[model samples]
Target: MPQLQSHTIRYANPILPGFYPDPSIVRAEDYFYLVCSSFEYFPGVPIFRSRDLIHWEQIGNVLDRISQLDLTDQKNSDGIYAPALRYHEGTFYMITTAVRGIGNFYVTATNPAGPWSDPIRIPYGGIDPSLFFDDDGKVYVTAQQGADYNSHAIQYEIDITTGEALSEPQVVWHGDGGPWTEGPHLYKINGLYYMMSASGGTAKEHREIIGRSDRPYGPFERYPDPILTHRHLNHPIQYLGHADLVEDHHGEWWAVFLGVRLTKDRYSVLGRETFLAPVVWNDGWPHIDNNEGTVSLDMAVQRLPLTAPSTPENHAAIVLGRDDFNEELGPQWLFVRNPSDRACSLTEKPGFLTLYGEETGLGEVGQITFVGRRQQHLHASFTACMSFIPVSDGEEAGLCIRRDEDAHYELGVRRSGGRNVIFARLTVRRESLIVYENETKAEQLLLHIESTEKEYKLACSEDGQNWLSLGSGSARAISPEDFVHKMCFTGAVVGLYATGNGQASKTPARFDWFEYEI
Candidate 1:
């Protein structure tokens, strides 16, 4: 991965890296703020602020509290969906549908960082809700109610304070009769109300289309062709669509959307990332990627003074790197659901992160003891130095590369029979299989997984240098396409985990350091 300096005049594409999808962005004066969907991952709706569109810094997460979001009964990949970010007057409003927890809601805050309002459930149906503030002091909420080509979008005026409908929901357009018409955003430019949306399912044929109307609703004239896409692009960027447009301080039009890096065999394990491309308006219709209809790894745009804002080392430093557990956990770390302060601790054992070994979960019915971060690269290696001793046959602690609970691979050290051993397990939905096992004499072990675009290779080492291959599995086995029971919407993650099978354990697994590399 080529690195870009924060102070560089020119920046690279994918200004926002990792699994950031369904981007809703806006420019407030010289600053730009963006938000993305978090799915079932906790601390949902990650919010980022950028002085220029190039260097974005994650300020905070919207649903950072349990009272604001509840995903207890939600299945894997069934939580927060697309979110729309908008700033009006002195308020910043974030509107979206929490797919499984709550239906439609919006949160607000004056400052992007703290004390965001809890979910204000709006009496709306469907997913991917967006908010648009018209010049006439009217606020509109729009959403897609159907799936695939049957999907139709409707908009209604809403009172932002109480989430109350001010007008009846009305269907504006059917979106060019495209497959999976969704992700609608409204913008008024040149006295015309334009509705930009994503059509075609979020797979290979995804595209961004634009339609305009004289009024806020009804009889929108949809452009015959998509404004942005990469279905035919030979570049590494794929799954392109779901765009939001904004104008910079220099009056230059820009569009931010989501796209995945196509690795080997067109496999994308890092998930959808936010990409930046210039928008050129041609006879009132905006063009993306410099009017080239596609985006690439690098983009050309005007710099924003390149103000030196102390940022993390790199993309890997922000989302894909080593953790010595010396300081507080940053925004990169995530938990399954609502977490407590007792879940992960560094002060418990000096520099090591001690995860309290949770009692076993029977058939995904109990709490899981783990802390993970999203896998944000096509080829990634995650290694951890862990020391744990199982109290009983059920206790285990090791590394796991998970897509969801339904599909995942785990390599852990546990006590089986009478001797301590290392095991590799592959699970699809509820079915589990022990792919590899070996007796070990190491008390403190180095557990790792070399994840590539097409395969996941499990490896272990008694010491950091002497590595042993445990087993290998297809990368698709842990992808959204491999779910056996139901469909999946989230990407893969690698983390440290400890569980006691079904029984309670007071022991904790200590991890000295966790490192990641390309």
Candidate 2:
């Protein structure tokens, strides 16, 4: 494989923005499809398509119907974790972890931009489920499993058509010298089965580890050591790993992985984001560019001609915050937990989306409620204006950027003392609202948030003019975990939301507009 001329590692400025994580990419015909893990967000696993890897557009979602995915009792960032996307024999398959119930499930579709089928539950217990189809048509799925600290890397020969485990999963490797091991992928090259996974933790200590086996079922051998590791750095950036391998049409190899950028002290609030790196073969072994384990923020490489662009500048880009909800909801927006199609309406009107307030109260923590998109990029602002006649005391219509129940900022119109008042509330879980204020006549409040490389400032304006500073909030990027996950793949979305006790007639909030600026 001939390598392109050396260039700086250029990141396509946030292709999806907002909370998209653990990206899985597959090439289908002239288009490349990407899917990301959407935890607790309804319409799970948004599917995006790109003609060039740099430019991506949201097609639809794989888990639109509640029956398609299980999210019962799952909290924010806890339902679906890492998802694997692959096309085998005319069927596009997505395997993922449904953390709340039914462990792992596989969904299939004929079209990458799909009318996907309901999930076919695969009786397996693991996160980061991946599918690998061999030349013989043998389908295999790999995942990380262990009761506690003792975990093993495992894979199972699967029935591609039925999504069933054909045989018991066998342990291929264990984290002997490595720290918390997870995110496993299998590939075959030159008669050798290559297994790549992330080890160390999901922090700055992450590294990409490689193992190889002559057979599908591995008596696998670990590479002399990790093919890529950042363990050598004294004060390392949180490079904790989750990786996927991709090859271009030219047969050149590349790996897409997730890492975090730290800000002030030990805070990494941006969430784990996807990164690309070159891979080279050394004496039948795989090694990342220099095998240093950590991908450099300054490193640059020309994208393979066949690799789809993953940036917003691309034509296929999915624009969030600005909704003409008539078309499909772009991959950026997500509903809390498993969203009920009946809860909201899009596609009915050409440019309008109406959201009916669900029974869940916005104040309740961890409730299967609220639809939101991720907040991507540091210096981006989202604005949405809605008009609603509150039906009850709790009914509120507003805009919010939420990470979990505990951490979020909300600006909306709420009825108080039999009158509508503009209000802003910041909740950092268990703690009381950090900031709360009510304006007497805030006819239309444009909630503006500006995030810099270090901090975030929140402001509101009346008539979308003369912005008033509402004080700034301390923002710190955190790693993706059961609670806080890195914001990668998907950028933040600004749109309409309504919550509280009310019928559609009383709670209907007509969104005027939503805008996002980066």
Candidate 3:
């Protein structure tokens, strides 16, 4: 086999930020296809492609049209969990779980970069879904299924031509040693079928486990121990689990899994993030990076050949941290649920994007109806200029650093009494929207959020000068557990938004410019 001379982890600075979790990858010809979990964000399952895994570009999303999936009455962080992307017989398929309305749905496209078909619901009950096509064209699906509170590893044989299960699903394994075991991928190599899954809970202690079976559906046997884990790191950010395996052109294998790095206090506000490690087969089993069950911050081997260098410049083009909503939402932006064209309008505002206040507050409406990008990096500045007039009291518009509706820091203008007030609020959910009043007053406000490795400080300025500190609150950096939902999938996007008390007929906010720098 032709071997890649060098393989290195390039693009360590988050290819996609904010809430992109459980990435599944496939290669076609010279380009590599990748997809990530969108959660409540609409236009769910962003699809990206790369000639070299180091430089990725967003082509489109798998779930673009609302008819493609169900997002009616969905809440924040409540839809579309983990998605798996695969290609076979000149067609690309993405199977995902729509947690709220549809259970597991599959969409297909002639091209990985696509005009994908509407989601066809699979009667199977599961969360993280994976698809496999065998050499003889036998199709199968593996997922985490069980009762509402308990989970079991299940698999079913299916007909690929029609997304129908040929056999009833059977529980091949149950999560015992670990709290929850899910996200399974079945790969066949050298007549051996391998099952890789995420075990433990999706928290700081998550890990990836491996099992094997000669048949697609069988009495699979788990390796005596975990193939990869974060158990050794002293109070390390939750590690291991939620993994997908792929082999490059040269026949070298690698695994892309989610993990997190923590700040001093063991906080990972950013959520779980994607990490890569080399996979080597040993004694009829697979191990990570030279038979070591764990990965180090640095590796000395290559899984793929490195490309030649291009022309040098003052700096790499500022690929991340900039957005022109003129086009479709960049990979950096995320919504609470699947998005629709009608939820927002760049055409109505022209040169600006307008997000109409939905009936649901930031806590609900996870779809494209209430979209927010992620906040990554320790030291960064988020600024946005918007123009809006609140219609009634309790209506607000401006910038926010959000986890869910309950946990966030927002600085905006609200209709308090009859006057517009500049206010800042910390949301801890079920508790009061902790309000902080700014001494300086203004009708229209320019919102700014700044963060260091420790805390977040929010401020506002009228003429871009003489800033007033609305308030300062503690901030946590990104880690594997939080990385899944904290940051936007593409990258941290500093954008504009508007939300009201849900009583007004309609409230609109216009954003002039949104900028972020690290």
Clashing pairs for predicted structure model 1, backbone only: 148-180, 360-501, 406-429
lDDT to native, each model? 0.79, 0.66, 0.68
**Candidate 1 vs candidate 2, TM-score winner:** 1
lDDT of 3 at 234: 67
Comparing 1 and 3 on TM-score, the stronger one:
1
Per-residue lDDT tens digits for candidate 2, residues 1-518, read 96755334454423443455577788777777888777767778888876655566788888887777767666555678889998876879988888766788888899876788887877665777788999887888888887435666788887776777898988887754666678788889889998887777765556778888888877778876666656565432456457777666667776666655555555545566655567788888877733353366544555445543445543344353455455765556677775555566665444656666766655453333365666666567776656566746767777776555556666777776777767677655425363656644554556666667555667777777687776655564222331333322322333456776443325666665667767
Instruction: Tell me the tens digit of each residue's lDDT in model 3 across 83-115.
Output: 999998788999989877678879999977678
By summed lDDT, the worst window of 10 consecutive residues in model 3 runs over 311-320
What lDDT does candidate 1 reach at residue 392? 73
Clashes of 1: 3
TM-score of 3: 0.88
Clashes within 3 Å, all models in order:
3, 42, 37
- After best superposition, candidate 1 residue 251: deviation in angstroms? 1.3
